[model samples]
Target: MATNDNVYRLQGLSCMNCAAKFEKNIRAISTVEDAQVNFGALKLTVKGDATIAQLEKAGAFDGIKVLSENEPPPENTTPFWRKRESITTIISLFFIIAGYVLYFQLEPKSPFTIGTFALAIIIGGYDLFKVGLKNLVKLDFDMKTLMTIAIIGAAIIGEWGEGAIVVFLFALSEALESFSINKARKSIRTLINIAPRKAMIKRGNSVEELNVEDIRINDIMILKPGEKAAMDGEIIKGESSLNQATITGESIPVHKTFGDEVFAGTINQEGYLEVRVTKRVEDTTLSKIIHLVEEAQAERAPSQQFVDKFAKYYTPAIMAIALLVAILPPIVVGASWTEWIYLGLAVLVVGCPCALVISTPVAIVTAIGNAARNGILIKGGIHLEETGRLNAIAFDKTGTLTEGTPEVTDIVPTEPYSEADILSLAHAIEAYSQHPLASAIIKKAKLVEGKKVNAENFQSITGKGAKAVINGKEVYIGNSVLFEEIGSLPRESKQRISSLQAEGKTVMILGTSNEVYGIIAVADQIRKSSFSIIDQLFKLGIQKTIMLTGDNKTTAVAIGNQLGLSETRADLLPEDKLTTIKSLQQKYGKVAMVGDGVNDAPALASANVGIAMGGAGTDTALETANIALMADDLEKLPYTISLSRKALHVIKQNIAFSLGLKIIALLLVIPGWLTLWLAIIADVGATLLVVLNSMRLMRAGERSSIENNV
Candidate 1:
């Protein structure tokens, strides 16, 4: 907020419209250059120099409160019974119960009986009237203001029972609304509390337990078997498998050892670990995820924006129509004033836009929060909605659809040599270089530490291969292109190279300046889930599943055939991968690009939705992609798609249910069949129903990808 200064938690804000109202008012402050209210997450951020005092005062005007980071949450200070809305609702219930006893079990219309009903109205109506009267005085009408007028008008016409019912039902719905929403919000709190507050740090010859906030960068954290990693750090000592479900959403434990990275909340399943902290407590990936997720929940979807726009004009139009229904009938048609006026009040009560206004935000918030818990990050409401509409998704071949690690499958010599001879020389050259296939050749030859051939003049050819001087021989260990540079790739080897490529093996030429010595082939296996995931995408309505890779066409086609991909583009540079994404976009209205989020960053950026793999790049997944499937599991892609489509359907159901129910309730009024109690029931009932319908998303996404065995 203000480039970096202001972030506040909003308390007592359950209505999206009220949050918008407070936001507009805060931005109007001269000192507040910008302001945003995240209704779903209940946060307010401000720019410029607006102090906490200024924001709190402004928010208090609408019964909303702003608590800065340093301030204690309102829940800690205020008891449930002492809260204004809670206290008023409790008091209103008392009077309504007494009024019901007097009317149904005894006599009606006595002064004492009517006085009891009047007490219900006055007690229940106070909170609404406080906010509603202010709005009425300013001509800023909303649901509260509408209810306030309807209740007063009902009591004036001697319908004491209906008036009490309006207050009691309205207050009941408000309580339920708060309860249901807080239930949805508990997911974020649960995630925030995952990491232990204190951690065991390794000091000189001893270990000391300290609060996470007290831990500093470069601190050595000691994690024993079965202990969670204390902070985001590099593993300086020990080896273990880590269950990173909290960050990566993968249930399988990832092996971690010397020089490997570990996150603050991941579990060390075995062995001992000494980690050197790389990030401060607040800057850990988990903390950043929590903050960005909260912010993402605040963004509005297209349907949400549409509802807000519709509510702006719909409320005033309803009021005008209700006025004409009351006064115009008596003036023009000579209809009974009493009956028409009652009908007008019924229209006002039913016409409150509470249900319609809340339809989308609640569902979107619930769905997004649930997705986060399950290892998929739906960044914003817009992305959540867009993901629902994706018809095609392009996958990066290496890390996305296949195991990125390639292994030596074959070693062949050209002339007067055995496989071992070719491997010995190839491993000699590969040992001195860092290439994707270097370890494959070295491991095939069983060349261990202190047993490798010494070499010098090492140079790596990016994307093609590498070269080195091995045992006084200039050996080229790379693809055919490296041999072509030497003015010769023997014609006899072309057939063998073609055969290897056709089998999806990356063929590397082993030769010198004089003649070709040997050839080595490496192949990375396809992931076990790739075939089923591709099939599932089609089952989930994906029109096309394509692969983009820099591998040669023969190898790409070979892998593509095994996986049954709809299409494949091979032998392409990074730029070529990006252009193919554009072509897919032109072919499909909306397509998703899935990659590792590093090398594929350009194509991932260009697609309609970008999904990254692994637990790496938490911030990139946040800032770069619309969605992220943790652990790089292609199975999560279908689950992500299913969740998005489910959320979309739920949102549409809510909007239609809210508006359709209201229209039917209003139509009953034309026949003079709608009563004050019935009108309020329809209005408040829809609000609670809308809220409950949205809350279903909270648990609907609870299915674990691990338990599902995907």
Candidate 2:
């Protein structure tokens, strides 16, 4: 279903030059106020009151037609025989065969030959003639006008056979271009169809089927084995191994428990499950991925802009040169009129600029679509291009390089108090704070389940830590700095803290004004895949991987060394992280900052490309990152960079191959080696090659074979 609105989704737009032409013409129509055509996105947005019939003429050359966003598709009304392009192709082919048969097999100079040839010219090239005549009368010279003039010149010179063949081949090329674009559009259509149309939801106690949109947030949905999850939710009952490749691009089936998260479009493999929907249908991660991918195609890259602007004048310049070729040699060196005219017509045929204009948009669109199919979502062409050039990457330790959940690893208490006694006191004071360390101490309290310490006068010391009075005694619980301020921290406690920090643990001091109680150690384990991912990045030609953290130098260095990081800047506040990101950008050409917390937002904004992990579950993931890896797996980072660089390489290759052929064709004009048919073939061949080269990016997911080197 589609809707008729200002934003019109389009299909069957194969030619970038023709799309540009449609944009220009549609804007000029009196019923239109504004028109914009995104060639890569294959969409046309217009503010107008024009009917479908009038708009169709604007897109007639490119075979583009608008589709509504929320209306059911109309049934086919035209018979297959009456389809305009097919009818013209069929009728033109009949006249072409008839003309050749009458001339060679029957009568050499028969009137039947001329009649059939004229019919072929009129039938196959009628649209070209009409557009060209309109443009000529309007004093506008474009590709259609260029070809029509060449066709008339050939006929006037009595080269009817070449002219007739030229019309037939050009029509066939247009049809082929249309078909190629439709083939590419099918990929996006498949993505749209991945989610199931209907979902089963429980209303009160009854399970009923409903449209996906009608299933609201917090609804209970039952997922049968081998069925796709209808919405993003948390499993409330049962267990299953779900294949989540559609959302995260992970090949393995992930096991889900009572509270584990699941996304729409992922299949439940083993057990039936009840899920509490966490997000509405439109707010699901799958929908956002599709929207971002479409928007990315609309954002033209710098190279694409340059090519499009160059094409605006490239054709007219060629027409001027062809005029000179037609008249100059005949006047200066007594060359034959028909011979020079023939060479000029060949030049005109080669100067359409279809291949040159398509060079960037097709590659950009194909690459964006390919990346979306995988887990890595590149937000736009600019970010995609920047990511491929990144030389260094900075990672925030918590929730990124390390598992974010911290645990109390060790507890050291002085002679007077037992381990349980110290933990109860620490938990009572830590419960007043909301920091990650506080959470770890509270969790330890629950595990050891002892008498609660009733503390009075709770006060937070900002970065130092919190303090509270326990059991009518002036008590303090914090780091060494907070305890040292009251002259209560024991000198021997420094040795114990240093030893624990060196083991990559955060040490917290629990003490009071008169005596020290103990030191509690907490540590967040580094991700098992972090070292391998860092190694892969280096193999992919990344020059540096750095860690920036607010943790002690001993702990930061411990983690950095294990991961083979180039540098570790420890004990950094949020502002320090921002400075490190800016400094990295200075030393390296481009730096990508990876982080998931609010503290990392500044650094992420300052970096060349901001990469967020576990975008599927975060509110800031989409807004704060240039690229979002839906799953938290660090391995996807290397794959993302490799895919971006591959796209860049293909884009460069397509542009080079297209322009190089045009240069060689233009050079052939000097020796008059270019013929009309050869020139047309070269243009069509170049276009097809550019399209085929861009399509190579469709295998981005399978390109993980390069991960060994990376």
Best by TM-score: 1
Badly placed stretches (over 4 Å) of model 2 are 1-5, 29-31, 48-54, 60-63, 71-140, 160-176, 217-219, 233-241, 255-262, 270-280, 408-435, 438-478, 482-493, 509-520, 571-576, 705-710
Off by over 4 Å in 1: 1-5, 61-63, 70-98, 105-107, 197-214, 224-230, 269-271, 411-422, 447-494, 509-519, 615-618, 704-710
Candidate 2 residue lDDT tens string, 1-710: 34344766676565666777898889889978878786655667788677666778888866667776432123334554566876797788789888888878767456778778778989999977887887888887877788898888887876666677778877776665555555455455556667886889987989999888899888999999989987899999999999988777777998989999888888999999999999988888787887777778778887787887888778779898889999999999999999999888988988878777767767677767766677777888888888878999999998899999999999999989888998999988888888989999998888996787788789999878888888888777778788778887666888888788888887888887878888899899889999889988898889999999988888899999988999999999999999989988888879999988367888988899999888776768877888888787788898888877877776788778777787788789888888877777777777778778777766766766434323
C-alpha lDDT of all candidate models, in order: 0.81, 0.81
Considering summed lDDT, which 10 consecutive residues are worst modelled in model 2?
Answer: 69-78
Candidate 2 root-mean-square deviation in Å = 5.0
lDDT for 521 (candidate 2): 93
Task: Assess every candidate by TM-score.
Answer: 0.89, 0.83
Error of 1 at 140 (Å): 2.5
**Candidate 1's error at 571, in angstroms?**
3.1
Q: How many residue pairs clash per model?
A: 1, 7
Residue 41 displacement (Å), model 2: 3.7
Evaluate residue 162 in candidate 2 and report its C-alpha lDDT on the 0 to 100 scale: 68
